[model samples]
Target: MTLDNQHWERISAYLSGDLSQDERNAFESWLQDSDSNRLLFQEARLVWESSRIKLRVKNPATEEELLKLRARIKSQQPAGRIIPLFRNSALLKIAASLTLVTVAAYFYWTLRDTETVIASGDQVLTLYLPDSSRVWLNTNSTLSYTEDFTKENRTVTLKGEAYFQVKRDTAHTFEVVTPATTAVVLGTSFNVNDADSATIVTVAEGKVRFAERDAAREKDVVLTPREQATFHHRKKTMDRSRSRDMKFAAWRRYKNVQYEKEVKNSGLYLATQYTWRKNQINQSVIEGTIRNSASLAVYRDIVLYVTYSQPGGPQKTSRLVIGETVNPGQTIDYRRRLLDIFTETNVLHVKVESAEVETGDHY
Candidate 1:
């Protein structure tokens, strides 16, 4: 039986689990119609398995072997033996081996040209590049680098806003390419915002060479710390100015503070001081202060795990959420009433479970 594009698509969908139950049943019934159909399906499964193999390291010498195999297969293929299912078992093995080699060659070619992509949606994301450089991607941002990154090149393409702390490499300068402009630096921390109609570069440390995408070297501006540059897409013009405030990179600092708080929150940076008592109505009343000890971090949305025990019974844990903010070395007090607790219930422990860093985006 000869297979068309639709048959190939059906076979692929069946293997990938994309067919519905009814469609799957019909396809299986069709597969049972003839011996040739079963043989073809088996060959297709072997090809699918070959495609799933992960080829991490490519050997350059395999190109010659692949070429020789292709030539051998081509010489053996005749119009009369196009399907080859009825052929001898030895020829069938050769055909399967050729399929595997073809898939391997395709993977090698694709991996050589593949790019590493990192994107963020509603929340911020932090990533480390192959060169050990750190990047904080803001909401709706995308960053991609080629496979040759940190080896033959140290360049990245950006689509929204991101803060980059590029590693110092004197020999290879790091470059950030946007639609309107490009920023190059040896080692620096900077923010790049590529919006709808323009691209902005704000330097926090070191120096950045900001220029139009297709501009001359002389037209590029070297911006030092606290300097900003803008490139307008419509007019294709570039401008430079000094920024008094460093709020352009506030997102990076906010994310870093949150990360530090999470890393040091286990009885080190955040602590709870509280007192609990039984009210007149026999309800549990808890009042306390959540203190942030970090010198530069602010925390909010504190969630406390309250563990209580009944008279001669097992302990039960309840969650309490405090919609408050605690600054560095500052304490925020909160009061919560537990109405479901029994009159004789005792408060055993109250500990800070988690808290979110106060991130106010100024950009």
Candidate 2:
């Protein structure tokens, strides 16, 4: 029997024991009318079971094996086949059918078809975690997670600043990976800022272990609360600092643009803010954006320099370091002034780091 919406619904209701006595009798009679209906019902249940096998990784089965089983279903060449009548005799089959339904319901409710938010300067975002760990994203940063995040392991890769207040789950430890550092927490609270390779992990509650990425590009090291770990991605060096930002701990309360914290770039490849007040960098107040249009504001005579080991060789190293912010669109003799500044200050590859704010001069 070809199953339509109504037929599927009837089959589902009968399997779930939702059908009335009269409806159940009718379904049983209908079930006997066509062996095709019975075959289809079993086929659908098996499909549900196969999808859930991934969640129960303890049991292993390949798609090819399942497909072979599906092919064999056509062999209704009934030899030893028997449909038990007594309800007690069908207990195991009923349990398997209910499990398929339960898993299908869970997949429908839990898997969110979305992407992670990675904000930059003065930006805010919301993140939905697999274990129901909700994160309030701050600005000048990026956050990303795959839909299949928990299939193998509970992990989310990130770049450029955001704070996390994790939900505890002992079965799987949540790991935050940055280019320079790794913050591993099972159920604690912390802030992980990875802006242009200047990675900082500050723990507020419980504990977290901070470490560098392994040669296989996996997380290493661990950390505890009231401690802050800093690392430079390119330099491959670890730096430790005293915890100053106490607010980095809180979760519910958030930041609204007062334009505080003049964060030092600290050889930060991307622009960032740092304060020496020995104050706290709360997990609640972080923000920023990646500037695609604003690579640099035209300042001086843009001297294009390239290192050539030989003729027509691919240029090797480049640098652009700006002393401070300048008025936008101001023309500069990059040749006479900018190159001289590069020679004297050793800061070259400079770009305009500006932000667009609606109704304010915050950026």
Candidate 3:
């Protein structure tokens, strides 16, 4: 399970949510190929989280400098003998300093570490902990665990917002540390939000012990499913109440409902023309016209579901994003070019999946 530079690059891309659907599927298949692959990926992920360094080098060594370094390395070897670049650590380091290869080497060297995971920008990250616990981090959130993680203790510090599903380990208690509050449980699923002026803990399943981070155990409030506890930041006080609704977890549920509504209401028709150029690298070109039939709605960021298959083979679907705006009763034309399409592929199907409607102020 010794990963090469290319594997490391793919792992990095997967972590950053930069891989396309096809690449993601391939990487996931590779990950499931063996347990060692999964472990190596997890180790690299830890390093990635701990370093928090952008893989890009600000100032890279020039070509002449790289050549000189290589020449020096060759001079140290015996006559008529050459060492592989990967076999020599010194050469690897020298080359890493010169190019993007540094990212792979850096992670490889420190693969045994990190205790923090952050979900930045609009990325929502799902993490599988060492103890097999699950955590879903919302945007702009941070979660850090102790070095002993699942060994001697199961504790994690959280900032911003995160949802946790702790595995049942009767011998050890799971704990989540927020700025003002601490949530302790043997096994439970809960949401913790520390981003606002008050820290909020909402229990979705099982039970949790909620208290001030530094308060005595006597002050702890026991919360069951559908219960919530709020710790005020300024007043340093705690409030417990029964949750009548699931507003606390709305952030996790809103996206699906919104997307489904958009897809259901989208009144866009798609007509496609396919062309295969056998002489030019097996290029496949699809020209499509999208017509908006809605009378009052304007759409943008249209997502198209495309199905293609080789003759007598199973169909495969992929998504294409079109950012062009189409007004009510308007038609827009788009062309997509794909290279190296299978020579036997003769079927192409396209349809609008979803689109963002412009409602001016509100929808």
**Candidate 2 lDDT over residue span 1-363, tens digit each:** 233333334455564566568656765765565455555655554333222211332222444443343344444323333233223323334334443334334323333333343454564555667777756566655666655556544666676666676888887788776644567778886778776767888876787867775322234445666788788877887777778666553322234221111121212123332111111321111122212212122122121221222244433433333332322223222211222211222212333343222121211
User: Candidate 1: which stretches are off by over 4 Å?
Assistant: 1-113, 253-363
Candidate number achieving the greatest TM-score relative to the actual structure: 1
Model 1 accuracy (lDDT, Cα):
0.70
* Per-residue C-alpha lDDT of model 1 across residues 1-363, encoded as one tens digit per residue: 344333344555666566567666766776666555665565454334322222443452466664553343334323222232222243233333334344445445554456667778776777889999888888888888766677756988888999888999998999998766789999998999999998999998899999986455798999998888888899888778898765776665544544565545634677998898888887888998888876445677788888887788777778998888776568788899876545588645899888777765332
Question: In candidate 1, how many Å is residue 122 off?
Answer: 1.2
Query: What TM-score would every model get versus the actual structure?
Result: 0.45, 0.36, 0.41
Give candidate 2 misplaced runs (Cα > 4 Å): 1-122, 215-221, 248-363
* Worst lDDT 10-window in candidate 1: 79-88
Top candidate, metric lDDT: 1
Clash count, candidate 3 = 0
- The 10-residue segment of model 2 with minimum total lDDT is 282-291
RMSD of each: 19.6, 20.7, 21.8
